[model samples]
Target: MRADAKKNYSHILAVAREVVTEHGADASMRDIARRADVGLATLLRHFPTREALFEALLCTNLDALTQTADELETSNSPDEALVSWFQEWLVFAQSYRGVVAMMAAAHTNPDSALYAACAEVHSASARLLLRAQALGSARADMNGDDLFALMTALGWAVDQPSFAPRADRLFQIVASAILTNPSSKDIKNATR
Candidate 1:
């Protein structure tokens, strides 16, 4: 890419990040272009679709989360690691407004732009869940896809103002349900 073109791409991505943070997954491309002081055509040239733009924007964070999951597996006990990663994943799911739907869709669609990133998250989640289940702490009936769906539902609740206040409580409830034998210390450590 030429210097000017690269500069424009970076600027557009930065502005899109800001816009998405404020307005969420449905944020308008035109508005992002306006905010970046770039033409709509320029924005479209760099990101042909909304999913592509979000995939680029969230790639770093998703990779970091997956890496964190890897580290937590070795550093924490099975239950604690699973719960800790769950909390982190939940926070990431709620980072941008209305992104849960995109994640949910991408999770099942191989052709989606966000599919690879979401799949990585799903795989990491499965590993943690499996680790916990191996220790008899987590429920054996559940899998990564179930956890992903739960996260999506919780993320949806967070998008609604009224339900936002209950998200934490709901999280605890869900966590408790996932863990078959959560000790007081485990719960305390996980929730923190």
Candidate 2:
């Protein structure tokens, strides 16, 4: 990509994140172009379809989240790392309105850009789950696909404005169910 093209791509992504989050996954591409101060053609050139733009933004965010998970896996205790990653995943999933639903849809649509990103995110998540499981902290029977699905559900639950307050408790409940030796603080936090 040329310098100007790269700049446009970056700008479009930034503007798209704001517009999409505020307006929804169905936000108009023309609105994103206007917000970015770029022509519709420029936006279309970078992102031909709504899905393309969404994939770019989602992939960028997930990349950062995955990086954080990798770092946590190395620095934190296995179980703690898993919890931390899940917490972060919850945040990531709940970032934009309807993002969880978008991910869930894309996860199954193998032809979609979101699916590739979801697969990568799932792979990263699996690493954390596997690490905890290896230490006998997480559920022994769990797999990456199941973890991803559970997380998608958690994300969807957390995305609701009313359910926001109970998100931590939800995480704890799920974590406890998965962990052989769940922490007391998390358990207590769930109740509080």
Candidate 3:
């Protein structure tokens, strides 16, 4: 791609991501083009279909998240690292309210690149969960699958507009439940 073409493509993707995140997956490509200050032809060149654009955006975010998980896995306390990662993860989830639906749809499509990206995130999450278990921070019986389900459910629950105000509290409660050591004093102190 030429320099200007690459720049236009990048801008379209960035704007499309924001629009889709805010207005939902059904957001229009023409609107994205306008937001990006590009033409319809440019948008179509970058993403031929809405599904393609969504998959691209979703994969990009998941890739970044997986990288963050890798970094956290190397932290001194695997338990704290996992918890901290969840805090960040919840924030991301809240920001991209439709992401869970996109991930689910992608996972259901075996041929989609999003499926592969989802698998990578799942693998990275499992590693983080295992490390937390090794550190004696998580319950011995709590497997990676369990943690994954819990996190997904919690993310969806907290993503609701009605639940927005209590999202942080909800996350803290979930984290406290998962963590081996639960202390209200600690949570209070941390909040302060």
Candidate 4:
């Protein structure tokens, strides 16, 4: 892209990020265009569709989260790495309000614009789960898909005002359930 077009693309992405963070997966394309001070045609020229726009907005952060999994794999213990990555995944899933549904759909849909990025994230998460399972720390029956589903559920739960306050406790419960042997801290945290 030309320098000016590139600048506009970046600006639109920035504004879309803000809009999505506020309004979620249903954020209006027209609103995003208006907020970015661009024509709808210009925004559509860059993104083409809502999925395309979100793919551009989230791809960088998704890649970074995958890289974090890679780092944690080598630097942390298997259980610790898995737990840490789980937390990170939850944060990413909740970043843009109702984005978890998009992520879950993207994970299952090969044709989705976000599919490749979501696949990478899932693979990274699977590797962490494998490490923990091999160490006999995590449940052998639970695979990456299961973990992904759990994270998606927790992400949705926390998005609800009524359930938001229990997010941490619910996280500990799920983490403990995934692990074969819960740490004292994990058990205590879950109960609280």
> Which has the greatest lDDT?
1
Residue pairs that clash (backbone atoms under 3 angstroms), model 2: none
Model 3 clash count equals 0
Please list the Cα RMSD from the true structure of every candidate, rounded to 1 decimal place: 1.4, 2.6, 2.9, 2.2
| TM-score of each model, in listed order | 0.95, 0.86, 0.81, 0.94
* lDDT, candidate 1, 21-69, per-residue tens: 9998999999998999988998889999899999999999999999999
Cα-lDDT of candidate 2: 0.83
Off by over 4 Å in 3: 37-42, 58-60, 183-192
Q: TM-score for candidate 2, please give it.
A: 0.86
Q: lDDT of all predictions, in order shown?
A: 0.87, 0.83, 0.74, 0.86
Candidate 1: deviation at residue 149, Å? Answer: 1.2
List residue ranges in candidate 1 displaced over 4 A: none
**Candidate 1 local lDDT, residue 122:** 88
Clashes of 4: 0
For model 3, residues 40-116, the per-residue Cα lDDT tens digits are 88788788877678767876677788888888888646766667667666766777766666665665577765678
lDDT-based ranking: 1, 4, 2, 3
Expressed as tens digits, the lDDT of each residue in 52-75 for candidate 2 is: 787888877888998998898899
Q: Which residue pairs in candidate 4 have backbone atoms (N, alpha carbon, C) closer than 3 angstroms, thus clashing?
A: none
